[model samples]
Target chain A: MGAEVKQTILNRLIGGIDAMSPRLRLAAKYIVDNQSAFGIDPIRTSADKAGVSANTFVRLADRLGFDGFDDLREPFRVSLLERYDGSAGEAWLDDLSHAGAFAADHARTLRNEMDIVKQSLRLLTPHKAEAAAALLTEARNAYVTATRSSYALAYYFHYVARMSLPHVHLIPRHMGSPVDEMVSVEPSDVLMAITFPPYSADTIDALRLARRSGMKVILLSDSELIAPAIQADLFLKVSVQSHHSFSCYAGAMAVLDSLLHHIVTRGGKAAELRISRYQSLREDFGAYWRAKLPRLRRE
Target chain B: MGAEVKQTILNRLIGGIDAMSPRLRLAAKYIVDNQSAFGIDPIRTSADKAGVSANTFVRLADRLGFDGFDDLREPFRVSLLERYDGSAGEAWLDDLSHAGAFAADHARTLRNEMDIVKQSLRLLTPHKAEAAAALLTEARNAYVTATRSSYALAYYFHYVARMSLPHVHLIPRHMGSPVDEMVSVEPSDVLMAITFPPYSADTIDALRLARRSGMKVILLSDSELIAPAIQADLFLKVSVQSHHSFSCYAGAMAVLDSLLHHIVTRGGKAAELRISRYQSLREDFGAYWRAKLPRLRRE
Candidate 1:
């Protein structure tokens, strides 16, 4: 609910006599005006300060659609309690203050990430995950590239996907002669590009060139503006905000982990069968394996 | 405190009590044992279930040196509220049960990460960060190599460090010719290697070769087991454990952030002078230059 709507409801409940009994309405008005007093003083004292009887406060609970005053006021009490400031770590109070600020920023970052997840969920087609999975399963060669902050996520996906897929390449960090390796990106291959703000010029250039080269593109970016949504076959935009000037990866990590889990879970049975067959085949070719098997030679 | 210490304290508090307080002591014990139930149910109902009077509960609170029963019970209530169940997503009541658990886990994760940061602070000598800053400030080249899960951290550090020191190079992802790169690594150059389990063999190899080449190494790994501590000039271990089997980078991320903060904060007047110079240089070479430049006619 928006703050405006909640405030309107609160005002009506306090102001409208039809909405509440006379004495109960007065108590509501008192609470609305003296919100800070609730944190510093007890409920009984606050009630006395408001010139309302305890019975009237009980009636106020009924008017607010609560079982009792305890029910009506518990949330407020809890919020106030959370806002309590009891200083500790006396030697490093400045550090403690920064830590407190960081905590608040971290919460905001989580909430922002949650919002991004919800936005992506709303905009993304239902077939996106399945289609992406199909490409992951069918691709001949997969190339994963992420510059700057997004590099790790791409690297992990590449590493894990390589366990099942045939040929996988991670993009080079340098723009030197290693750039020639990317010339092999064909139509059958899938190119995953991960980049976030401030985006690397080289990564964006590489991704653009790869897309022009006709490889299927999957892009993960921090903001939708930089996501390359139109050119990419699949796009996921993850916004991570940090309390400090940097970015938070809590949501990004969660999403990546979930994707890995889903992929592995979906292919588990088939993967197990493939592994079993592969093991049998390995044993069949025991002589060839044994020539290079240092551990097995010791046994 | 250990559970044994807590149990001893409880016994000490109830030691002198004889006939009438025995029931109150039992009620206190019941409160501790059935905390989750108390969080979900009302106080009066909890008293009934424990076969104790409300007065006895109040007396137990008094015996514990609390102002009231509410004060004694609130922490247990909050704790019970925080315990989350994995399967709670399927049902509303189950979700409510799980919400508490999720909150508790979140708090625990924060605590664990902070503990790691404190440990890192203690383990890391003042000379370490200072030496690192000095080397980085003076180095002709700095290469950061982190593969798989540790990639994000490396990239983040690299990006931030590049703002002040532009000679930083992130290692190429594919292990195509790390030897070629290592050939260029000099005694004055710094190589930062970051890896976590299941350890990336490629990163370990890169670090081993870098060490052999006499390049200064800064190592970040999950545990001492994955990559031996001797490979790096400065080796930091950040162990992260979650309820989930796969290790999370919460601890590593926290420590890295703290390290970055400490470097910037403790680098003192020289660092401050360098930062201000960099800022002024950035301003001079910033976006305003496009507007300030003379426009050329298209041929």
Candidate 2:
């Protein structure tokens, strides 16, 4: 029910946001971006998180044809109840400010990250991975791309995948934009894009271009409700929740790790031969450091 | 006890490797890396994993002044027992190829990642995070560096840290090696270098330079026994173990998340102010994507 209310609210807000005042638009975007905040925290807390005033919530509710803030929260309340029955780590952590964030408690931090990993793993079930891997293995080429914080995630995936899968490529091969690299892309290719909230324009544009080219896409992101995610051929949901200020990527990396395994499995003997050859090349070229003992080498 | 034995074996191999023949050296290095392979797998399995013959193990042991393969295995067995008693995820996942590898079991992969997260958290401990955080807070500047696969880890840290703490820098700012960046580093600065097995020479050299120039150091790696980690003032151990062929960074990202939280706390009002400003500038400059509904936007 919470998910339903969340989705409904998103649908309405994205449509109505342009008509509202700047402040209302800001609050609406915040609500949409932080999908669970309203369900998890009080209106005041949600407002504070959105960096808007409590009255702004009431006004935004009014604009949405709701009676008041309480009415606005009712759907979320119903959904929150359903959420409590399951969805362990989704809403339990919101601020993490007072106790979890500032506490310097490494154990709590570790637990928070692990919870994210667990939840992300749960969301990205084996079924989804297998489906995604099948798409990847079937594609003639797979291009991965991201910007800013998410670039690291895409880089890691492309780096490791390229070691064995020569067809894998990281986009924006030069310094332009992902769209610049989309020129030669074909329908047989796949685009694996990683992005989170405050999403980049280039990534969305890349997704748009991929859609136009009739290319398959796998989006690794925090939410499936986004337009690109809904349109994606496969969406690997990764929890970006964290104990710190930044959204965590542990779960995203975990998802990629599992996906890579499937690619290897699907690739079979060819993948193994490629991996071994990559290994030997690294060894022969002295890509890795060998143990050096000056004293023993004297002999 | 297992740790002690592992360290002893590492020290012996590093000192004696130069005197061994090529195949013996390969076997020695394989043992040094995949550190627990010997104890966890049988002679045949270990030899296969090492990509060398079983005779290579016996000959390598002979060169190390051990009786034979059994003599080398004894220390590992003792260490293996000790490891089993305490370290939950360490030795158990030596090779995931047979059952875990090819199977498209996302749950097992998730569980594998979570196990790594659990063990990495267990190893990092609250005390270590506090100490590392304190070092990070006290440093006039913190320079984070890594190469290839590990670069993502360093990049994420510096990227997040720079938002609140402007003093943080990602080394090798342009094209030169990390050692080139160490010229201006001072005792007041701290070097946080991330690397794992098949470690990069640039990172190790950066650590060496930091040590020589009186810059404090924090090492984030899969193991604490490495020479660079040993010299580091603080070591935050992260597990790179996984159910896939690649070494997972889920644990490493978790560690960085916790440490970043500590930095935020330690930075206090300044961090809060900087973070808010950074956020607002992004908002004011329209750095983030706002939902656009073309149909609704039609006047």
Candidate 3:
């Protein structure tokens, strides 16, 4: 029943997109694009994401024949509830219990993961990556921000980038106040924000703060239709879809890896020297284990 | 030249495997199985990994007609040196420079990741996953630890497990001292250690300390030939190979996901209730974004 209502809402939004005002058009487009997220997220959150005011959301809902915003959101909530009501858990167990079931499931997962990576690659063009890299290269400082599951990508990017460039930082360091961390982000800085569905409020807030501060914002997300993408100077979409409840991150990791490689390679000899120096320092610090065996027999 | 020498060593080990005594056979088996890693790691590390004393490593070298362990390790070191001389970097750049290169590279990475996941699935059978899940279900406390690149897997595992189980802990919390964190891990507790090649010394040290405290260790790694694997009550191998410099972690993540799903489903209603409680609490805390729009038009 809820799924039917969602389908109707989706059909109405898609059909009505042309007749809406510019702001309503943007809201309609976002709703059309992120129907899944729209179903679950709050109006204020979705409004903030779509780069429109909450008033705009209410007007759009009225235009769509809904009694109120809550009515519009009900279908999404109902669908999510149905999804979380244990069917996935049962299917997960059934897949694991039988012979060849595990193998078949694994094969399907691999295929889904591959499809995600392909989609991400198609979305994240090299031209856009190069442009983003140029911004990072030219910026006085570079800051990376991501929350929850997406934080790993931010951390990995910061860790590897800082090895070759000295000005890279991971925001909200040591669980400090994010506002405090963003205070120093100047207009000359580049702020890279990564967030996907169940989009993090903290990350969205950070991106807003960065934009207000005049920093060049590079947004890596699952889609350009997302609200954070609206504020981005450069928006790179990377798919994170998966067969399981949690999203797969391989595509994100690969995209970041490629971006870093471009940055380093473009930086030329200076980057190479810095990386070598870092490697040598790591060796000097005894950071890696030595493989020496005993010499008793030789003696 | 280095490749030839490494190949000769591999052939010799294979030819001599059946003729050796049981202990020597074990050493030979490890040496042959981990030929790639053997070429890079120190002999003592390899010997320790094979569950033999350093003296056995020296004796094996003697039996192989090497002057000492150093001589036996020379080919592997030389091969590693040749590899590190920079062909991979050149190939990486070339792949990124052309049109459709990004798409092609992504496809290859997806294929490689799929292979890794398949290999890991093959290694980690249903029976083995059930045994590990049973241990996790029965444990009084479950602590998860992984560092550097592999840390994401540990974080994801801990995050999801904690949603359904109260006793789950992330080791070395907030990047604090691992030793201090493990001080209270009792015999009834379970320690899950995840590490991969160019493995972190800190994780290995933590695993050793946990073993000394009589905690059961579940080790997740790229290969069973690693030193920590020897001490693992449960050693699960998940490949992390990639065309790029850094390893792909999707395989490890998939394996951990499957393991956790098994645990949750096997734990039945208790796990479901806990998860629901977590979801409800998240909603209550306003941890998620709400979609409420302003009442401007309605008023």
Candidate 4:
């Protein structure tokens, strides 16, 4: 399939959404709403969930000028293969519907996270980590950006990083537009963007603005094939696949922690002094509560 | 050992902190600063990191009226045993310090997280999960409280829960004191408290206040031996031990996810409508980015 053909199909789907029959509209809505799932789910299952017949799915595809439903699904499948590692976790979700299957689901989710962590470690070579750490250490200022599902990871990273490094900012400045925050980014600074599919557009827009300003961009995403990869100065992939509707972030958190650790350990006396100061201040502010141990007899 | 002796030792340590010699002060500071490590690390290693002689630790213990360093460390060890599962990850840290050991460390951390997840699954019985879900579903209002490292988990939980259910509040209003927020909580409400050691004093205080208000208290903690556990109307323990300095949250996140899933799936039509409404609003707001697939030839 050529780019033109894919674009044509997508345009037709978008343009013709209003004119389709109710059944075709249901199928179309499912396709548009769950593009990722459409890529991986079987046609029959997709039809069943969308409450449409498989024949309707085929008819819709034919209406859209595809040879068959497979043609319609081909772009999605290819995208999935290029952009994600491992299966789509539909089977894991199936297990979750069974009675007393929560334990099994939990186990599978953890196992999946472990596998992702291992894969991330394998993919993030020491050389690349060292390079990324050096960029963070050398940058005059750094900004971190993530949105939606990834916001927690960004918040944690920024909270921890700001403790040991000066001038580390989490964009788009709480109350201001993210674009406004990206406006001041300079070549001497770095923007560490954390995003995964469905990737946050705000983060991508920030990345674009930062890149245009000549700021170094460090992209932490689920796959290198993501659109933002082309703009990144350094790209690190960490898997976030989960059995549930939301993406798992355990692997992403681990990667971010490892990156922060690398920067701190690789940084010399300056880093040590900063961390020690942060620790002292934390203690003084009573950020950590002392455990009130119940008295026990000495042996 | 009886409780009185342990209290005596701890009291002595706190009382004598101001008058100790410089070397003893160093050991004392290490003990105070890293109580968890003091509980788990060997004297030699702890002293080495504290930049003091092992003799200083013994001397400090003696000054505190202990038989030796072992007596000084005993309470911490006991507390560790009662409150946490698995080793304190000394070996994992050792592996981290070695050159080219990042992969090994990553694998170990993931493995440890997997074990914790499994242990948590075993501990959190289906009956308890169902009961917790029912409480959440039936509550007139629900509030979540957590502090410091555990704050992210609380935020995620509250964020997701509020989407599917009404009247879910994250405790300790962002800009105001947590006490201010707790004032509005009524007996009919539910307070879900997430905490781990060293336990946050603020969260514990909130829990106490909520209990006094006659609200149902649901405690999610690393261990049932924690002080707040006694006051809890419902207690759920999930291990957060990891191979790194910070606690692994994969297990905690899993438990929270499971709880939410239970509430949603069992909530019937009201829940389904809420979720569907949420999904539609998310799309309307462009909360999810569309996938930009590059065209690929059909095989």
Candidate 5:
């Protein structure tokens, strides 16, 4: 009764929504979108949140041929509880009817990405990754170099690792050259560089400078042959397979994330501990908003 | 003889490098880092790139007891050719004796990320993803919002899609509230949001605003139940599994990349066409460098 009756009433409201006046239509939209909210919040609260008068909902209820607002709300209240209690979601998960041709292509895109991640992970090779992580960890300073398309991966890696490892830094900081950042680097420092073909000449230059400075080089790249140029001490291969003829960053993304995870693990300092300070500041500064108003009651 | 003599020469130079004068050590460092360059470039060119006089090479050759600089270069030149022709690189790649326990753990990190990508891709459901991409592609404007950890994913997605789709924008533009960026949005717009556990309240606020504005909502989250609150027209689940208890972003990275690929595919626009203009500007602005100094000639 909970599923059937509420769905029927929902269909009736949805079925006749466009024919209704704008006011009733808005009310119907609110009810449909906020069924769980409506089941919990007082109708006045719901009406206020919906930006419509309480009489609008009553009118929508009248239009739907419900006796009144409470008559309209009762079924949804029972349905919301039933939704909370049900295993029916499993059925929805099992339904995989391919809607169209585009869907089939979309599916292939995901499969390709998964395959790339798997293949790339195999290339990372645990021993090499540990040695790579060790170079960064043992260094007096670890300068990360990447540009253009690979910048996001470097940022993600640097942002996470920089939290616990104070010595790690992203080079070419804020539109400056890697030379500017590497200027003060000691011979014992490490350079972790990310690049893929058509590799940026700037990245190669940075790798060269790191070598000249006697810094250990750890490279994440799409090709093994790239190592021939800079002689990267530890090479992490990022497989960038794509039929789209563009850089697919899934491998780089996974490899960098895994490396950062290793950095955090080796540091023995959980990010939560270092991050709580900034988290509290964000809260204090009101950088976050509260969406507590429209929530369904747990009880 | 080329490989063996080159190896002995390299080992001797590396072993006795520290005992040399600062100028001589710099030359050795240059030779070590640019092995192929030393093998291919004119000695004068190598000397200039190494920032040393040609006398430095001749004197270094005298120190190594070679007949001259070219005599020293001959072995490296032959060795470089051998490197290009040999199948020996496979042995180096296969030399994965785990240095310690950390290597084993690092391997697991990669394996875990690969699994997360696989698990999350299955959750995307091809038809649902195609519909999601269509919603974004067809929308008047697609507003992407995420805070904290998920911002990087939104940035990567928005950065890629906004190149081709001018209507796609990241909300809370440069420290503004999502409401401020979303204020001008019409009912035909779409709100794309990313969040994981302990989700940001502001993301939910933006979703609410999008709903109130009668815009379609598409959410990428760690849970499907998230759609129940916002009534997201489409939901793409991101799996954030990690043993260390911090958010793992591989799935989000892969899914968002795949979704953007779908959007580009549906739009029939490759990113390169639009990106070429900025790429040209970068070249004009001298934002790149030349690593052309170091090279192994193709011949």
Candidate 6:
């Protein structure tokens, strides 16, 4: 679900808890009201503060699909962490139940992320994916431009795609007439533009110009409501969740990685031979990387 | 093994094959003598021209540790495709038996890339990664400056890192005296410079100026040989394999991805909180990527 939808669900749940059994509803209210203290305070301490029985809290969790109160505390702890720095995490541990609750919530979030990934894959038409692959494979020249958080996504894709194609260029930032350059983009070439919420004006301008030149365009964005659809040959709408305060990309990165794998797989025999030749050159350079071995340091 | 080791092994294998039985040796000689042309002609056609039996050609593949003749032909096909584009593949289909050999060779290249990634991970000291992370994380302002191909790499890193840590800037190309700006850089701020082989003289000049100001410096490069290490508080060297005539980023992207993962993991609660707040605002403003997803087709 998009961020707006998810937040709306939470808001409704909070509003409707009064319709439940008296004790269960009371526990739910306490949980919601004291969420900011979840990780910092033990459930027993929270129970004491909320004036609710521990069993009632556990029962409320069960009603919410959690095994016990610990599950309910997870989201609360995450919220606390999202609101404060790590230093505040210690303050949250005033009781041990907070950690267990937080872990359970995190586990659930990961499961939701997996579901999103599957849904995303399903929503992507096979023809669109194949078209993207063809564009990447056939481009004599590929230009990738992105700004803000999405720029890394474009840069990573550009770097990998450049290996098998010719004349791949990464457009420079603030360079004169990025759009003018796009106006000359060849018919067979592709311009990949990646942007998320609060899209950079420059990236949008470039995509508009590239499309006007009759070049193919691909977009990776957060919502269909605000995305640039006119220039997009293929558009992928992704909903990202934050672990703390910024939008998450674990899902986006996974999808991008799969796309790269698919491109290489379909490149046929020519790609294989080029890779073989590269292996020879790598050995020739001694490639200073040999000095470091596994289990040495974390990069 | 790097490109050098791969080349050495190839040479050794070819030499050993040349010294074997007369028929085997002749087959090897024909292949070695016409390495470049193998992709241009089918195996049967080439074998007939060499006066060697088709079965003898199959044995040559087996002697080279290939499953069959098709396996052996794959490499040639790949080479031609990468070097000559798709036109060459059209001319090279006569050798149906060489496919199997080439696929295995290609798989080996990915394995080499994995090795490079492993080595890069090991070489990147946790101390440096943390120091670099902390420098950028704590900076009141950060500037990313790079030229040529390295420029995209620098911008990508800056874009992602800037999400949680705001106040980061991407210097517009040729904006003049990036050094002058760095001269005013305080101890709490940082300047990141990226340059790879055939390193740009201008990039070096800027790094030297930045270093003199006692501002934190981070350097990303492909080879330490070409990248000066003196001015950097942290240095990361990544190796990229060449495919066709272009350098591949299997290693560089992997290292960069890993860095982002590590930094976010270490950022703990602060990152999550920042992300949450950012997401909230992102939904409200949608500034990151609004224009890339065009809604209507343009003529």
Candidate 1 per-residue lDDT, tens place, B23-109, comes to: 876786675565445444456877898898778877877877789867665654433322211111223222222346533333333
Off by over 4 Å in 5: A1-100, A224-229, A269-272, A275-299, B1-104, B224-229, B269-299
Q: Quick one: RMSD of model 5?
A: 25.5
Which residue ranges in model 6 land beyond 4 Å of their true spot? Answer: A1-147, A152-191, A195-299, B1-115, B138-143, B167-174, B186-189, B227-231, B257-271, B285-299
**Interface RMSD of structure candidate 4 (Å):** 16.7
Clashing pairs in 5: none
Q: Could you give candidate 2's per-residue lDDT for residues B255-280 as a string of tens digits?
A: 78777877886788889788767655
The 10-residue segment of model 1 chain B with minimum total lDDT is B81-90
Two-way DockQ contest, 1 vs 5, winner: 5
Cα deviation of B258, candidate 1, in Å: 5.1
- Tens-digit per-residue lDDT, A1-299, candidate 2: 23435556778999988898988988998877764446445678888998899999999998888888877776654443222212223232222213453332544565567767766766665558788888777789999998777888888888778766788999876477899988888999999989875566778789989988999989888744333222578878777765444687878878888778778767778887887676555434333334453211111
lDDT of 6 by residue, B1-299 (tens): 12222233246558797468887777777766665444345677778877887888788778777898866766654433222111122112212213455433333333333334433433444445556666666777777877544565666666666665676766544446456456566666677776654456556666776677667877766643232234367777655433333344434544454455445655677876776666556445444332344422112
In model 1, the fraction of reference contacts reproduced equals: 0.07
DockQ, all candidates in order: 0.05, 0.12, 0.03, 0.03, 0.11, 0.05
For model 4, the superposed segments whose C-alpha errors exceed 4 Å read A1-128, A225-230, A267-299, B1-125, B223-230, B242-246, B268-273, B284-299
What TM-scores do the predictions have? 0.45, 0.63, 0.59, 0.59, 0.61, 0.44
Q: Which model scores highest in TM-score?
A: 2
- For every candidate, what share of the true interface contacts is present? 0.07, 0.30, 0.05, 0.04, 0.28, 0.11
Worst 10 residues of 2 chain B by lDDT: B290-299
Q: Predictions ranked by lDDT, top down?
A: 5, 2, 3, 4, 6, 1
As a whole number from 0 to 100, the lDDT of residue A141 in candidate 3 is 91
Misplaced by over 4 Å in model 2 are A1-105, A227-230, A280-299, B1-104, B228-230, B283-299
* Alpha carbon lDDT at A44, candidate 4: 82
Candidate 5, residues B76-172, lDDT tens digits: the string is 7655533221112223222322445665466456656765776577667776777888899899989999876677678778877887688999876
Q: Candidate 5 overall Cα lDDT vs. reference?
A: 0.71
**Candidates, ranked, TM-score:** 2, 5, 4, 3, 1, 6
TM-score of chain B for predicted candidate 2: 0.60
Q: What RMSD, rounded to one decimal, does every model reach?
A: 21.8, 24.8, 25.7, 25.7, 25.5, 24.9
